[model samples]
Target chain A: MNPTSLAPSELAYVPFVSVDNMMKNVSAIGVETVMKGIADYIEEDFLRWESFDKKPRIPAHAPQGVIELMPTSDGKTFGFKYVNGHPDNIKDGRQTVTGFGVLSDLSTGYPLLFTEMTILTALRTAANSALAAKYLAPKSSKTMAIIGNGAQSDFQCLAFKTMLGITEIRAYDIDPDASVRLARNLATSGLNVTICKTAEDAIEGAQIITTVTADKKCATILTDNMVGPGVHINAVGGDCPGKTELHKDILLRSDIFVEFPDQTHIEGEFQQLPRDHPVTELWQVYAGQAAGRTSEHQITLFDSVGFAIEDFSALRYVRDMLPKTGYFEKLDLLADPDDPRDLFGMVLRAEAGRNGEAA
Target chain B: MNPTSLAPSELAYVPFVSVDNMMKNVSAIGVETVMKGIADYIEEDFLRWESFDKKPRIPAHAPQGVIELMPTSDGKTFGFKYVNGHPDNIKDGRQTVTGFGVLSDLSTGYPLLFTEMTILTALRTAANSALAAKYLAPKSSKTMAIIGNGAQSDFQCLAFKTMLGITEIRAYDIDPDASVRLARNLATSGLNVTICKTAEDAIEGAQIITTVTADKKCATILTDNMVGPGVHINAVGGDCPGKTELHKDILLRSDIFVEFPDQTHIEGEFQQLPRDHPVTELWQVYAGQAAGRTSEHQITLFDSVGFAIEDFSALRYVRDMLPKTGYFEKLDLLADPDDPRDLFGMVLRAEAGRNGEAA
Candidate 1:
């Protein structure tokens, strides 16, 4: 049993997209184009919600932050993301939320792709925000107030502009430097960007409000007095237990739509509301089974705790686009033996080959 | 925001051991030595079992196979293994089980090691069995009858020989070629091996019996008639629901010890017993809180469905051995921006760097 004599099939190689390749991929495909493509996939999957096996992200909480595993399957493929949120990671020069994901074939349970999702997560979060706005926001809306101008702000602005024809963004962050950074990044993004001094100033007269603050506490980034009628609030920041961005009064008045109620009740802005409070599943709205923004005076809120299915869709998109973009390296992730039952023999043969090579 | 200007700290590179490197590592350390080392770690972790956060492996079952995530933490570090069980994968030249794992810092939730676990899992599963046998098996046991001599058989033989001083093995498998394969692989080892044609013949004069057959059904590999007094049984293969290797009568007569009752009741041979059936936690036995092998005439069974804590210990062992073995590659798995909040800007700068290099 020589290792050199053992041959593995193509399934042994998993396409891996690193940060550099992911950047190149975004640049080659155009950020807005990729965002739109992912949004379309999200929409299609949402329409067939019954096909997906959905569960709340499994969290392991420590003193500093939380690490999570979000897994989902569509009977044909399985996908899961390993993500962590440590707001204080910035002090140590690490992203507040870093992620990686794997997609595998259901028939064989072999991983097809392994990828860095720090950037893809930002993209999918934005695409999901805009997709929600398309259904819940007031028609003819052209202005959005981004309250947290951080890593996610620029993508949120572009996604709205690309997916829903929003051309104006009023952005503000507690950290003025973050606002400046967002404004500079979006200077060429074809959106009229205004860096406001305060969240109140940013939300003034805007039809959509997106809050993506980074604190791990239940701080109110948006008050009830600041939100106006017919405005859609995309609450993206408060995504863990004891973390909420909007005041409870706002949730009490708005028609809350959520990705998954079981998860949203624990990690989303909806955590501030009562457990049995009325909320609509966003998939129902996307599928035309439920109403979204039914009245002009209704305040619509999408308590967007990101879901596993969105990561699944994003992975599928990247896997399908790999042939065209060529932005992946093959990784020898799985062990393949010539005879599946001879795994021990394979290792023994490999040992023999190494010794032979050394000799 | 230039990619060339952004500096990531030393934490950005994760030590990744691929299949090739893992093979080299096993050869470098010697299989029996690594097995003994992992068994030692498993025993140490079991002593402080209350310190770990344990959960049943999260499974996504399709019509053909199942994919699972098994995670555990000790308040300081978090470890998880992504594994799949596809019995029919052999038809496609793939192992019945393949796995990969991550070990991360609990303080920052950043992964420190990413390694292929197909080989590590084989080693750990065998080490776990041998470790349990040390407590439950009759004293001076020197021979083991291994009933399913496929992928796991060689490792089981070596682990027992290394950890429990077993010097002889009688192997039998439904597929006789698998038994021949196991015997062939272990030929050069110091232990004496005998290939038996039937399960009944294999158990003769053996003090321990290990059943690891790979059928996805409740087919009995060992019955009441096959059992002898004072012999310990290590049940390995029946790991999921609807899979069991021992007859109910055999289970009724044995003093069962399990890693975690909640999981074993669903996946192990205990699945055949009643819900309120009495069993001892192996940790209690190891920690001396409960009794193990109290009499020479008692039949003891270690119902060994794998647990997350074992994988955690295995990961910890591998991470510690990396500096000595140097059988790993550094993976650029995380996206580290100069400003942690500027993930998009990092990608944008990388794009700019690519364009600048081209120019």
Candidate 2:
């Protein structure tokens, strides 16, 4: 038997989407428009939450980092994301987070699409945050303080602008350059970006505050002292087991909302809370079975750790939009034949046919 | 934000490979060559199993079928499979098992490559069988009886021919058409194919017996009465829990070998054995730390429930090979920029730069 290492030249061609194309596509569609569409999709799927077979992410934790597979299917379309979180990745000249996913049909079990999901993840994560904010934030809310200006902060700003008509974004990161970078990136997005000196400055006077800092520790990016009444806190960074951003006291005071309680209990700010913590599954609010932010003066917190169903919506959108935008290439993945059973016959015939055609 | 509902026109431009391309690639190099190469990849990774963050599959069981994500990653490369099992899929004009996967660098957490793992799975599963067989079967093994000739049968024959120098394949399937199809597919693969009327006839005097059925039920493809001394049983069909191929009596009589004891215990023929069946991990044998096929007359059973590491090896090979094969197209999925943190800058600038240039 020949070892694959001995035969390294036999590779298969796969279409890829670089970040440049993602940005180009996002920019053309206008960040505002994309966010609105993504929020709609997320909202619509949340309404059909029961139709989905959902599970908490399966993570493989190694020394350097953790890789996870997040999957969900609603008996119609199935989607899953393979994402890795490596905090040390940036030091190696790489993003700390990257991902890609596949979408398939349940009727035939054939994969209908393949996509670069890294950028899509950021977009969808932001979209999900904004959608949660739409339901949980005060109706007249406009100002947002974004804590953490890494890969995801810009999307959070963009999503808010498109989904909620948010025009002002106050940004803060421990690293001054990140806040500066966030402001510079938003320079053209048309949103008023403010560089704040402290997390308190970012969240002060803001109706919706978003925490998306990346760290492996229980760092307090926002304290109860920094939060105000009727503030919708979108906590996006405390996703994994030990990584958290909020002061536990803040969560105790806020009426918290979550995507999936089972997941949020494990991955969201709720992880720090008791197993029986009083958190509402946000799907109910979308379904009208539960109340969102009951009053303009009440505080609401959306513990946004990202979910597989949101990826389902985003992947579906990307797959649908690629054709209209003419930005993607189909990958030769599923074997198609007049006879699916002739899998081997196809191979033999392909070999034989290749020879015959060559002759 | 828009939901993706792609028609063929939307995907017509995606990079595609006809079955002919895969055949030519395999034939120009040979199927055996591919199987052996994948085995080396699988073995090399297995030796460092502790380095991987491994997870049992996350399965979504529907009334008629099951969808699954099998994910694994070393600190360097992350990989996962989106696969489903529907024994009834063929009746619905679909293969029972279909899958695809991605390989990404952990440092940057970037998905470097993606490929259809359906056909690659068939190749890898078969390669896995042959790999285990090489470690368990006698060097003089020349014939393999493959009972249950469904979609995966052809690869089984190919793997044996390429890995163990198998010159003769005696095939049998309850559906005679499946057997006929298997024989016909392998007619030109340089291995002598024989159509047998019964499982007993196919297994008679053959040194290797492989079962690749698609039935979800625990049907005994091989019984205790049919067993012979010194033969190796490559059980492929009895993968899921409650699905068994070799009868308990046969397993009791044979020395069982497994890839991952934790998984194979639940999904492989080991399920038929006690919780402590005392099976040898195949890697220990490959590492020369354990005995393999201890004697000439020993009956060995390599109960393989496909593992993620095999897919990892196959996916890595395809990623490395596609570029050299000239069968790839670049997909703009990753949001790569001059500065990774300036993600939002990417799309905004592209849009503005393009608008300015057009003016």
Candidate 3:
């Protein structure tokens, strides 16, 4: 694209919101503030959930991992996120998750923003977890148990501290060093951190239990016996068919709430439940049309198979803050020709810059 | 994402091949040369089509237009294209299509490269159309007819000229100005251009007839009687379920071929046919596992519903050519902190660049 001429043309300048920009923004506002802001947006969006055109994310499972596309539109704008999960990536010293997405104008079908979604997903996932927990967890919850501390531990801690006023955190990971790292990161986070040896130890005396274990298998992060009646389970990371975090009996004991039932049925902990399993949509709860945790003693579980709207919220948040931070560089994602019909000619010109001179 | 330290990290630098870089690369190579190179890649990949993980491109159809994600992987590298088709986009003094895409390593699920695919798609689609005509058309064929003269017409005309040695192109569109624009763009393209008064006039004496009309409705650019014996029909524009470019009788008379059956059955001209409509897979024929034109007089049809593999090949080729050009701007798509565990700290540090401070 002739980037110079695009400004004067009818084209929309899609503000690129990269991970660096998002991080810079997070640092400027502080992690606690960003989480609170994201939670507020997620809550606001969830409240008007009837306005969104939602669907189960489209996933492509590969031999090594899985790639997914989550798309949603709220009448006026459209958004989608492209993400990949390969746990083995960490063995090669790379992050287990990476993602990016675009938000476009629904009327013109032109992408107005492109943002890196790796860090943003962690943030959004954590925000969504805390948002659900706000509605489902015990009212006076002061202590939270986090089982499986990998890439997602820090954000979860940040969100809980910002929203629920949690001052103490108990963390457990299969790898002891991971728990040690989690403790060290949260050391300056103004919260008391406990390095528990097991999920049972982490959940002991905790008001809210959050599981974010990443394994392709259906592992029991929280079994029936370990969970208490008044506790709320914020289930993350068990987001694919063969991957689930909780035991079936544990899910059977709780009054399940889900992001989207069609997706939760295939991906969430509810995958093990029967087709006839009764559950309420989280959107309805947000709308105040459906009851949430009728009593403080009711056991509640949020089957969070992350939705596209959270990504939309993150992209918007990143876009609003990118200009202040120079953490992003623009790629000529569009072909801006002097004349749109002369696309062939413009390409020939770009080729000249690459291959020395055009033949 | 410290862009400078990113390349040395275990994660691959998915240096986005920008639109400017792509256009420069194509222009330097010349449209004909790039088309020839892309045509070779398309034929080679199509022959091994079964090796790819194929799914019909997911499309979000709106009232005005459609946005789509075309993804395919070869178990080694994963690729996807983000494209939008808004026919009225041109009326607002804009290109009717724009796109970008990525090629990622499946082993680590790392995005290896991000590229501008709007111009690349035009070039690849044109190359694909010409490649199909090479096998389906008679070996001695020359003249071709292009029933649509919009933005795509230039690429289609020039690609055929370069790949198939089509010396003349007969062009026609409902809007005479579009045909005039197409003719002007191809003035230096070396092909003999004929601006015909009607579709019938354009198809006359043409060995290969390509219909690339760009309306959402089922508008027939070719009638059964207009197509003669031994003609290769390149059906380009009837890509969505409700859109078709060729008359039903035209399909009835020709030996049909498709990119992927599961996709073409829903989007191509085959949507007008029975569910069990007998059509040959193009890859099987390229692999010598199936037949092409059985007789010299047999009419052949390549129902060209664009496939993900074409975009995959195009993205891979651009990735190779990007390093040869220094015009690309590095995008911070991934976060690489000195400490991977301290993602939150990276944000804190990146924000230091604010207020004219060095980040």
Candidate 4:
């Protein structure tokens, strides 16, 4: 079927990026390059954060997990991500996180792009971590510690290497096989990788500490003694309510930075702190309206809960690259009749056409 | 590609109903039959409305139109519809209202179905109107006066005819062509269709009056002097802020029934009345908890703003029928890998395989 043969009204097509196509797109553009591109978009969006209409994600909490819709708009375009977090899914051979996103024109309320966001989410989460580290981490930092070397650890390593010029990664996981898997994945990459036995050993001489454990609980992966002066903490795993990765004493000793303070306080490690605690908005820091690292000795922490704006940025980046990559399929996701008011007639004509064809 | 060949982890296919398929489905089942089926589902849901979580839709109002997310859950399953209402879109040959919905498993947060709801919304909206009219309209009513003959007119005419045995329809539109188009569509449907020049002519000797205008304003399609006793008013079009079809005096004189009182108070004809005004919950009437049309002289009005539960029921009906009808396509909307944690490795392996194939 030639899509161009159809009338404009009948050609309501949305570009969709499936998992296979997403992998193809990632391979087409090297993973590190894609990570850097996502970081650039994240930084660009963060620099103009006030232009976005930000709100706390709308979550439907169930017995086993939660489904959330995170939406943000920049007056011209609208984007939303439908993501689910079910830690128990892994036991059933499913990923703990699965996501898809839609980018739409605000004027028409029509979706322009629909894409699988599992890969994109991992890429953007790591990009966000490295973007924050660029502003908050100790300058010229070389070695970094990844406490939970799961699905996100490899992305974090590559993002930091590409975006922040970090060359060495010391990775540790509760499951030793996961650390081994992480190291194996980075074998071909130029960055040096070390598989550590314990979290203390992982963070021994590292200037950046990334904790990305998956348990949906308040477990302390980092303590006040583990985190030293001038070290940057990229807290990625303790996102939902009742989940924290760092001790309260460490949060009190560091200068906290967050995407949106209102959301971070509920979902990030900041959830452990008081609601009135001082935390600079990451956008403010990126825009130079607030300080990121005031002194070399001041410890800076990015309490990353992941926000809607980051998803919006990732979607925008993917949409901009679709034309060049052609790694997308058009989906017939909208109903458009020749006469907008003749919706019933459209159905009736289809019936008549089918009857004719069958006869 | 045989979907079953993939591991269960990679067999994440979601059934999608596109516009063409939706029209075919409508044709295969017959429009009125589908409307009746949806009405049955709506009645079943309404009878147990308390078991469902009901919240006002979350709306983002822009200068051109409004986008809304309406979500509801009945403990076991969750459903939400993404809908947009832009009245001016008709001028640009686009739909005034376009919608799509997602139904997901609450336990795992995996989407079970995604379907185009522009046509479904029209079907369900008309079904909801007719369902309410069954309880509120005068018994053995034979004719309905439809004041607006836009996209929703033909469905309303057919729904009342199918559900309430109303074989005659007096349809009038501000644009004469719209009324003519509606009449032409219903020519072979076995109903006596009349194209009226004015609203007064349309309602002449009619027992039921339905106003479904599309203007996003508080324009009175029916005034105090126009409606008489025992006339059941199915107000269909006015469903947003600053939009209503009936005058305040008409509402004051009528016994009002609504889907959800909180939403109807703001978006329905009751928006003209004070907050303290008494209104019967339609679900209560359906459940035998409240009265509906107690007197022959009483003016009965169904003030509907379209609730989320109705959309949920429609989606449920479609999902139940997909297996029997085979009227959907499987979409690869989720990312699944052999080892869910080794997402990056999966992409890397795909790259290597592609390179090997090329060589």
Model 2 misplaced stretches (Cα beyond 4 Å): A1-28, A173-181, A184-190, A295-297, A319-327, A356-359, B1-24, B175-180, B188-190, B288-290, B295-297, B316-329, B356-359
Better candidate by lDDT, 1 or 2: 1
lDDT of 3 by residue, B122-177 (tens): 98999999888877788877899999886677898888888788999999989888
TM-score evaluated only on chain B, model 1: 0.97
lDDT (10s digit) by residue, model 4, range A204-231: 8898999999999999999888888989
Model 1 bad stretches (over 4 Å): A1-8, B1-9
True lDDT of residue A114, candidate 2: 66
Task: Arrange candidates by TM-score, descending.
Answer: 1, 4, 3, 2
lDDT of each: 0.91, 0.77, 0.80, 0.89
Candidate 3 at B230: error in angstroms? 2.5
Per-residue lDDT of model 1, residues A66-136, tens digit only: 89999999999999999998888889788788999999998898999999999999999999999999999
Model 2 residue A37 CA deviation (Å) reads 1.8
The candidate, 1 or 3, that scores higher on lDDT is: 1
lDDT of 2 by residue, A210-291 (tens): 8998898888888788787888899999998888899899999999998888888878789888989888898999999999
Real contacts recovered, all predictions? 0.78, 0.51, 0.54, 0.62
Residue-wise C-alpha lDDT for candidate 2, range B69-151, written one tens digit per residue: 87778767778777878777766555677666667665455566655566778889998888888889877899889888887
At residue A300, candidate 1 shows an lDDT of: 96
Q: Extract clashing residue pairs from model 4.
A: none
Query: How many angstroms is residue B246 displaced in model 2 relative to the true structure, after the best TM-score fit?
Result: 3.3
Top lDDT model: 1
